[model samples]
Target: MFDIIIRSATQRKVRSGLTVSGIALGIFALVVMGAMSENFNQTFENSMSLTSDKIRVFAESGMFGGGLTDDKVPDVKRVPGVKDAYGILLTTFDEDQMGMSGKQIFALPPEKSRIALDPVKLKAGRFLEPGDTYQILVGTSIAGEYDLQIGSKLEIHDKNFTVIGILEYTGSFFDSTAAIPLETAQDIYNLEHSLSTIFAVPEEGIDSDILAKRIELNVKGTSTLSPRELQEQASQSLLIFSVITISSALLAAIIGGLSVMNTMLMSVTERTREFGILRAMGAETKDILLITLGEAALLGIIGGLLGIGIGSAAVYLINLWLAGKGIILFAITQRLLVVALLFATVIGTISGLYPAYRATKMSPMEALRYG
Candidate 1:
């Protein structure tokens, strides 16, 4: 039976190849899109780890809406269960100052910022120091995008500053920001004592939500959120992207399923006389059905394996290209391969059902006479 199925498929190489290609393309789409989504979720979770035990305090209105004063920092620190507090000043630079648009500038107190506690490893040079007034640390993304390197000089708000370090990518917004001493940021932006946000770490064994609420109540005109809340907000913002990715993959699978059904139906029609001869030679209806299903399953297994290899290679090349730009957008895993292959096989088996049934229902005499 297996030899018959193989011989039949090989006799029509062009049709079989086309059908396999369709299924492979569909599986490839599913694997690639699913891998991208997984990568995003993992990266988001990693970024959240940094703030999991901390609370973010920002103006009740918005980050850009009037912000908060430095005075709020002391009040937040005094809140119950608070371990430490620090302020961050955010400002944007003009196109001339930034050498491009949409880049953000962050002012963090060298001694008090979270980065100083467990510093991100520097790709070059060093982190900011207390006495470093005009020195800045650039995120990996900013450095790659602007072609900036250690010792590079940048003019911001008409003041010259030297790039003293490049930060490693943290899969977070920090990867795109330029950081300088809080005092220097204030002086450059003319923000005498204003802050964009505050970061508060909870005392050991303290609940982050409780600490956040305490800070919000103690410090008026400010809102506070735990790391989990921030992660939920980020997930909501990416909902649309996720939906699109899933929809495209599903559509491809449906198209591939239809192609398989068409190919199987055509193959059954062309093999009517052969099936008739087998039936006359004492082959049962069940045997013919199994042979048809076996052929479809073979196509699926081969196509799925090929698809996994091709999809994995594609993701690797994409990551290599994106790495130079300090970004990662895909993560292919072992589980993804298993699920993709299983999905392809199921789709192939289901698609072959109608054709297999038709082949069995045909009258042997009628098929022989028609042939």
Candidate 2:
């Protein structure tokens, strides 16, 4: 009986092909959109995970006084329930002052800290080392845009600095940044002995937020945040991307599902007499329903598989274009592939249920006599 259904479906080659193609296009768009959004969220999580694991306090008043500072670093470390703490200096240098484009670039210290930022990848040169004067690390995105390389010189505030490293693509805001030593940035920016923030890590099982509040009370003119809060703040920057990806994917999936239903309904109408004949042959309503539903499921599976293939290819092409711009973070893992295929299959199967039930209820005598 299943083979007969397949044969009958093949008999309407043109309609079947068109229906399958429509579903494939819809699922393709949905899968790509879903994967793109998920990737961004995952990237956000990865970038913030390490940052958040450590509580950070910043001075909230003076240039750096209003954010985190070294003055409170030791006290925060000594706070009850605190485990470890470190101080960081943040400042920016304007390149245009040195005859380069006047872009404000951020710099960080290369000291071991509670909240350490590890560069994702390096394309050229090396990271910061103690006493390494006039050196800089830049993101690949900036490297291409500025046509820079190892040993290339960048002017920072009327000072010539050599490019030391090109950071690898990490799908976060950090991918487009430049980093340097704390002292180097301070001198270049003319900020004296001032730091941006301090970070702390809690002891095992300690309530980080509670610890933060305790430290804040001890240290005047400062605020503290647990890792979770920092991540939310960081992810907030990418919230728009998440919304667009999810909304677009859902819309595509809905359109595809509706198309599947429309095709199933048309198929059922065309096969009304066939359903009547089956009823005359003693086929139960459930059997009729199963047959129609099964056919729909098979169509969905095919379309979904095709969609996955097409969508994956599209992602690869997009990545290729981005790679030329110094970003190569678009990765399609096995899990994503399987999930997309499964999503397509479920949408197809669910959409066909109503039409299949309507076909099962067709009366043999009535269907036979009707047009």
Candidate 3:
């Protein structure tokens, strides 16, 4: 039976090939899209990590609605279950020419500023320390754009800050940013006690959410944004990317399926007499159906395999292009590859089903008489 199926499938290789290609295309789209999504998620998480492991609170009453007046930080800290809170003003530098102002997060810790960005990847100099009036920790890309190195003097808001460090490349939005002391940033922005944000660490063993809620309710000037809140905002932009990939994959699958169906339908019509003769020669109706079905399945499986190969190659090329542009932050893992292949095979088999079913329903004797 298997031999017969193989021979029959091989005889209709054109139709089978089309079916397989359809499945493969679908799988290819999925794999590429999924890999991109994973990479983006990693990049986003890394960028947020720079803010440290604390919840951010912003003013709700004035400019941008999230800015906190300087006097509000102490009031927010006085809330029950609050350990300590610091004033932060997230903004873009006024002197930036690359339009990096809104793209950066400027965290201000008045005393011992605990904000550190992926310290493990600190490439040159050290993370920002307390009482360092004019020192800044710059990301690699930002550092290169300005030709900065340790001891390089750069001015922010008229005050010259010595470049203390260049953070190693981590694919995040912060890659093009510089961290300044809270006092310096406040002065540059020309705002008094008008902070755009604050960070709070919960007291030992207390629920972070409950504490966050309390902060929201009691802190009149600010609203609390947990890590999850930030992630959701980040993911909204990413959803657009994921949707595009999925749409492309679906379109490929549909086109491929139609081509396979057309090929199979033509083959079935051409083989009418052959099918009629087999039916007359004591072949079971079930056998006739199985043969047609097997042909479809065969096409689907082969096409799926090919699609996976092609899609993987495409992703590699994409990676190479991105690398050339100085973006080597994300990698496609092995698990993603396996899932893509399996999906391709399933799509191929499914696409072949309608054609196989139609072929099986044809009256063998009538088909013979007509063609």
Candidate 4:
């Protein structure tokens, strides 16, 4: 039966190839979209994982909005349950500063920034030390995008700073930032003694929620969010992107299924005489149906495998391009591969049912006469 199915498909190579291509396209969409969504979710989760027992305190107006002064840091630390608070000055790099726009600048006191910077692994050189006012640490993305290296000098507002360190990829926005001393950042931005945000660590035995509430009450004009809250907000913002990708994959699959069904129907019509002859030679209706389904299944398997190969290659090229910019947008996983193959197979099998049924229903004599 399998041999018959193979010979039949081979007999019409063009039709079979087109059908396989359609199914492959669908599987390609599924795998690519799934990989992208998974990568995004994992990056966000990994970033949030680093925020153990800490709450972020920022201006109610948002991170880019008018920021709080450094005085807020002491006020937050004075709140009950708060163990320590550190201020970060956030600003953006202009074309004059880094030959590009919107690259982030994070200003931190060398000693106090370790809590936030601990997650960042140094790729080359050393992190900023106390009294290293004119030194800067660049993120992996920034380093790659700007072709910067250790000892490289960056000019910010007519002042030059040496790149003392390069950080490993953290899979977060920090990957695109330049870290400098807080005072230097304040001077550059001309915001005397002001901060972009504050990070507060709760004392041992104090719940983050309780600490966040205390800080919010004690620190005016600022919003406090536990790490989990921040994670949830980020997830919500990315949900739409996930939905669109998945929806497009599904649409492609549906279209592919329809193409499979159409091709299977044509195959059934063309092979009517063969099915009739088999039935006349004592083959059962179930045998004819099985042959039809087997053909569709074979097409699906071939197409799915091809799709996996193509999708993986596409993902590799995409990652290669993004690497130069310090971004990764795809993570092909075992689950995605398994699901893609199974989805393609199921669609093929289901699509073959109508044509298979029609093959089974043909009267042997009528099919022979019609052929």
Off by more than 4 A, model 2: 60-106, 112-115, 118-126, 138-160, 165-177, 187-196, 201-207, 231-244
Clashes of each: 0, 12, 7, 0
Model 1 scores worst on lDDT over the 10 consecutive residues at: 112-121
Candidate 3: stretches off by over 4 Å:
1-29, 45-53, 61-63, 92-105, 110-124, 140-162, 168-177, 189-193, 228-245, 277-291, 294-298, 324-339, 367-370
Q: After superposition, how far is residue 51 of candidate 2 from its true place, in Å?
A: 3.5
**lDDT tens per residue, model 4, 1-371:** 78988998888999999999998998899889989997887776766776656899988897768768888888998998888899988777664556343367889988765677877688999888889898999988778877889999888668898999998887766677789999988887788888878999888988897788778888899998887688778889779878999789978976888888999999899889988889899999789878999888888877888888899899989989988866677989898899889888888888899999999999999888775
The TM-score measured for candidate 2 stands at: 0.77
Worst 10 residues of 4 by lDDT: 93-102
TM-score on alpha carbons, each prediction:
0.84, 0.77, 0.75, 0.88
Error of 1 at 263 (Å): 0.7
> What digit string (tens of lDDT, one per residue) describes model 2 on residues 1-371?
68966876677788777767877887788667766766667666766753556787877564444444456778778888878776666544443345132223655555541135553667767777767768877876667766889999977667788888887766664565677676777786776556777767789998887887887798888777767677677678678776787577767766777777898899899889888888888999888877788777777777888888898888889878866655544557677678767877777788889999898778789978767
For residues 1-371, write the lDDT of model 3, one tens digit per residue.
Answer: 67876786677666565556666777676667767776776777776775545677776764367456778778778989988777767676545545433236465762534333434367878777777767887766567656789999877767788888777887776666678887777776677566776778667776777788899899775677776776777688788876786678767766776666676677677777877887778777677777766666666566666766776688778877655433443346577666665555455446556766666677877867865
Evaluation by lDDT, superior candidate among 1 and 3? 1
Determine the C-alpha RMSD for candidate 2 after optimal superposition of all C-alphas: 4.9
Better of 1 and 3 by TM-score: 1
Best by TM-score: 4
